[model samples]
Target: MKIRRLASQIVLPILMVASTPALLHAAPLEPTRGGEGGRIIRVTTLAKDGPGSLKAAVEAKGKRIIVFEVGGVIDLQRTILNIDEPFLTIAGQTAPSPGITIVRGGIDLKGHDVKISHIRVMTGVDGQAKLSGWEADAFSTVAAHNVIVEHCSFFWAIDENMSTSGPRFNGKTVKEWRAATSHDVLFRENLAAEGLADASHPKGEHSKGTLIHDNATGITLYRNVYAHNMERSPLVKGGAQVLMVNNMIFDPGHRAVHYNLMNLEWAGHDYVTGEITAVGNVMRAGNSTAPGLPFLTLGGDGDLAWYSKDNINVDRWGNPAPMFGRYGVTKAKLIEKDSPMASLGGLDVMPAKDLETSLLASVGARPWDRAPDDIRVLFFVAEGRGEIIDDEKVVGGYPHPSPTAAPFVDKDWNLKTMEPKSGVYPGQKGGAQEKLSARDEAMRENAK
Candidate 1:
């Protein structure tokens, strides 16, 4: 599990640099042009909310792209930043070295057509009492659509680290429920880890990962890293259509990926069977993981129609682990299929064996300027040394990097995607360096 090469040294997929037509065709799961022809709005200060604050820029009227002139943590004072405006793009990559980090709070995406990348969200306990009902997700989409969240780091959330969810039963019909909830969203190449257990959540010891709430549709989680969290690396609830592809989950407490639909929650509405397509995923046990924990756990009163293929589940010693389990009083039906109902026709999905190498090299925000906490977490995953924690204090709490600011030059980047037109990113010295392909890497390894 050791990452033999640095992230910058690995050859990333084309999606990392530019979008292709195939990638774009990944809809209704793919995100649309988010704030792509919008006016540029610069966040010139690190204030929580003011004239030049990130909050102000997000709350601004009309379609806009929010770029940062300052770098460092923006302490929300335990408050959440709600993005209620639509068609917004937050280009955190435009920030100076050691890119933008939001701490002591979270971001709630309630708007449609939003794209955010290269940002870190570290929501610690903020001195709140344990089991006192204080909870926050590092990032979440609430009944929003056409959104993309990439290359972000989420840590220390009292609830799920990152999630796409909304009102479970928004309308009487399943189609209405799907429309009203979060859907058509993409979460790619992010790191979701170290949720705080037994700290501030009212439900004691609740340190989950991601929760795709009931009835949400067209959700795709691709190439993300989920580590050191208790469970729900994502839990797909009833009637949701989800595609979990090429993701890595390490050190889960009790479960890795699961599905459940409690009878009480869907008392009035009939239970619609959920659909899950899990492909090319890797789940490894770690220190805090439960013994003999199944890679996919099915629970509750209803059944789930799932398809799993090319997924690897192993224990700490690299021993093979169980693949499936059930956890409810009633005998819930488990529908296993040979092929998926829906196809990831346009996305690039690698084999499970190649997943760790790609993930270790690219997951998380600002790989070129990773925070010490993120660096440690990634290293721990490589060396297999970290564990699920009860508090963020165990890992030195939130960071307070000395704030740095620099002027942004809009001409240097493509305003639509915020990518550098000159092929040189912020932290790079010159043109992008050459990367080793998989074959070349394998040859080098053999030589060693």
Candidate 2:
């Protein structure tokens, strides 16, 4: 498929004089306060490849708000900036055009308390063998903590579009997500698309979207839209406390979600699966799509599954469609929680109606730029040919191949309840008379 990443280039002296003052100004130009409202560092150059340009601005001195004075494509030709600084922000919203687009390279975010907003990353748009590692994904962190990625776009990474993992990749160990162990990480109001087919990690034609690898913790995925890729619209692999809510997955080339418990991909040790709570999630087949792609994949022996509630198949306009016809989803029992979800653990589950409305309003970069409406990404929309995506060469194989011996149990059992709760129950009672109203309702309705 033809992929289009939004970006621009730099001019000479004229550009410098025109944009330098905007860069030096301290006014708040980003969507929200990042770097905890720290120093302002503006990116003045749009050079296709350079050292003291965009790359240097991000890795500048200390904690700061990094904004772009000019917006356009920066073809890095396979260079990756390892963002090891603490308390930093990459604000693409400050760009004048369609926002900053990076082609042929991606950054590895290793710092703490960082925010990446309003940018487009296309690591595979270039036909080169690719400069970075296989998993250099559009955005990745080995062990970054308190990181927030929102209102951004990623497509056609040689690896997954977005991911997090432990420090171990092979025999080599990285400090990204290793010693610190990621926690309180949030991904919201963003769009992830087309994980391109590549040979580096052969299992995935372009396998993953938002992939959370082993040993991460306290993740919150809220109101995002993931579309047209091989799989892993947020795959939960040996994660520790993940709360996924109000996200939509559209036209997946394979399964939409997988909770992988048994994996041998890492070099140091075996990967262990973690807990997940999925609420108000929508998985829908897109228009003019291919056939035979399933909606969910529970890896070999079906071991990992956690709390799930209120998932359905529908388009952006709320039109219903089969998530996948092969699986009889409505009656299947597919999810499991570490403990009963009744007590309502630490997850802050919002009312479905409110969450859906809010998400539809804010799923993309602009308040009105919802994914179904403004997302015109072409990689996933067009590129599905010549790649062999059978059982073996799937799961974006890297350190190890994902186990596909057992077929996924089509639907979630949610066996904790006699059945999954279907109606809207007020999440938190507000009025003083709510208890009295409950009693009165019980008395009125229980008599027969």
Candidate 3:
């Protein structure tokens, strides 16, 4: 309760300035059904705030769905946009041509029942010196719940590309910790890549992918692409429950999937074990990957409840690698299980053998309208290229997506999934495919 109270105090001032979140008249539905049948809010500007901007729409509240009438980069001006309202849907699929890309800032979810899809976020260095402490996550949940994030692209973050965070020990009991922290979250079919290693983070060397922070519960990551991040693809801490299925990890530094519980953080509290269920996942070593790194590593001071099935680990040359390793200095315990305690009933859990082929074609935000950066990242994943960079400028920096705009016709889309009813996504023709072809042609010319 103290943690919750502290969070309220910090957020209340922001809410007071932005106006308190409006309560939606409709009852909240499941995470997948976020903002269904709510008012449609159109974002028509690239401004960080004010009318017709994303920050304004999110701060306005109610069960609302955001559709972009403009397509371009929204320079957040190095400010993290906080979503502290519930029952919201951010439908980036509605953007015209090359879709919405948020640059120089990050999204912080502090609300419940939110669904975000088809968006790209690039939180770069913003002219900060290396290790100068200007860290940011492309997207993160702060004690938020019932959230679903899919078909998004995250890059160049100084901190973890995407993560779930809350208090480590909210109360005296494990149940209280579970209740107070972020829960029932899902991230699928996204690309988390190129986290800036040794960038603006104060600690330095913080190029991470996804981190399910301590006490977060019921988190599921399915069919996502994790490429070029140094580590944490991803790390699950103590008192958390996570299910990772059919995800692809490429070029992780020393870790791929790991579990840890720091004793210093839980000094006064009793140790609450973490649970992980990994199925049909694939990890391929690349140029930046540490030699002889295992697919999954167990570390830290506490024990872990783990279940792994049919996962694949291999080097770039197709040589098989270690499946598991122990990296903790402490004599930590491992509780291996015959079956997964968490269920993946609704997930389309595919085989590890077919993961790379399946993900390469359709990963990241607006796969049909992919910017050049997304294309390059996917290409690098396929070719076993690219290294962990300390800065975003190493890979051409932030792209300049051509600005375009068009009316958003609600009848043309399936509101629930935010997919086009006609089965033709924007920029599907004469766009991303052409860029890919051009890139290939240039590569061939260079080979000569």
Candidate 4:
């Protein structure tokens, strides 16, 4: 009996020690799970094209996971990559130093099941004068589906910073093609700033933040911030199931939330119709916007379920605005949960101070990629520094002035000089290239 007891005790201790590591390792953090258990691809350069470049890394075909070895600016130099692969993950959080930044060029994701996090993409030009204001957005998708874009910052584009659309399919623009091309898109904890005004639009103040085109669905914009822009703080058209919860809009030039019913230019030809539900959002209007600038640009055909529960809106004086919208109901005390879209509602609406603080700390290219100057010139206007100037100082900027932040860019929407030390670091060639190894060993993961 003594020998048996001794053996049992010894075996039990050994088993406990052996199983502890396995158990601890099994519960990885949520950030590590973003790859969705796909083949990992490690990127080692900021090159625009070719091997070790972001373009090539994204262009490669597979259920791939991409991690950055170096954190620097990838100057596309007027080039834009059209991503056509499905089940891809661009894990910007893997960058040890600064994270990845894409400038001049943009990524047009036209695939499915893609996830991107903790990255920055910027188009330098202010407006569409260059490239006719088309194909030049920080991140755009045409017929892309199930995309999760989180913890990213987009700004300084001639058009909307981040947008989803239904491109021409089978040489025709139809509902079926539009539906298949884009759906189930999510944007969380992101920043969309400084949209350039379009030359031709009704308001003439035609900058866009999140422009959802016809034929999109399950488009969720959660806990996002839009700053220093004109119209289209998510201009939606074409029928889609949209949930915008816990978002913040600061110092916009015009009204937010313009819902188009494909009634205007596209009209009958290519109109987007969808359900829109906005709740627990914060809108702060500085001196830049009109005194009575509304929170929503009413007028759409899609089903809309509007709840104003637990929202914070302040005017230029930092006074809580009584009305949330110029068109819809002003103050909503309690969100009606009896609707069918209860899950889309915000669980807890964050206060303005908390939301602002959260954005200031969490937005952009994570903590590592931020330069000292990034805060001073990150969004449309430097947050505290770019307070609204006198409206009369700028034209068409009637009660408020236009945006005043962001580095000067060339006409082609490219920054004239990408200072390595300022924005994303520019790694010197032949330097000890940092290597972000592919974590998925089950699949053949190799870096070229």
Per-structure clash totals for the candidates: 0, 21, 0, 10
Whole-model lDDT for model 4 versus the true structure? 0.57
- Which is the better candidate, 3 or 4, if ranked by lDDT? 3
Give stretches of model 4 more than 4 Å off: 1-35, 126-135, 167-178, 198-206, 265-273, 300-305, 322-342, 345-353, 372-374, 377-448
In angstroms, the error of model 1 at 384 is 0.7
TM-score of each: 0.90, 0.64, 0.90, 0.69
Cα lDDT of model 1 by residue, 6-41, tens digit: 234245541132121011112334566788889999
Q: What's model 2's overall lDDT?
A: 0.53
What alpha-carbon RMSD in Å does predicted model 2 have with respect to the real structure?
Answer: 18.9
lDDT by residue (1-448, candidate 2, tens digit) is 1111111111111111111111111121112234754666667666654553678777776767776656557777777868887777776654554345776678788777777766767666343343333545887866777777776776666677777765433233333333456665777667676666553454435557877866566677766767666677877665345777767676665567766544345435544445677787866565423454444555632234467677665543456654323222322224465453323333334555444333333344432211221333322322222221222124232111121111112132111111113311111111111112577888968985
Residue 327, candidate 4: Cα error in Å is 8.7
lDDT of each: 0.83, 0.53, 0.82, 0.57
Pick by TM-score: 1 or 4, better one:
1
Which ranges in model 1 have alpha carbons more than 4 Å from their true place? 1-29, 429-448
Off by over 4 Å in 2: 1-34, 48-52, 129-135, 168-179, 198-204, 263-273, 287-295, 314-335, 338-361, 366-374, 377-448
RMSD of each: 6.4, 18.9, 9.7, 15.4
lDDT accuracy of residue 310 in candidate 2: 70
Candidate 2 similarity to native, TM-score? 0.64
The candidate that achieves the highest lDDT relative to the unseen native structure: 1
lDDT of 3 by residue, 1-448 (tens): 0101111112221111111111111122224567888999999998899999999999876899999999999999889999999989998888897899999999999999898888999999977997788899999999999998877999999898989998777776888888898998988778999999888899989999999999898898877899988889999998789988889999998789998988878788778888999999999999999999999888888888889999999988989999889886796788999999787665556678866776776667876566788878887887789988888888888878778889999898777656677767666543224344678899978999
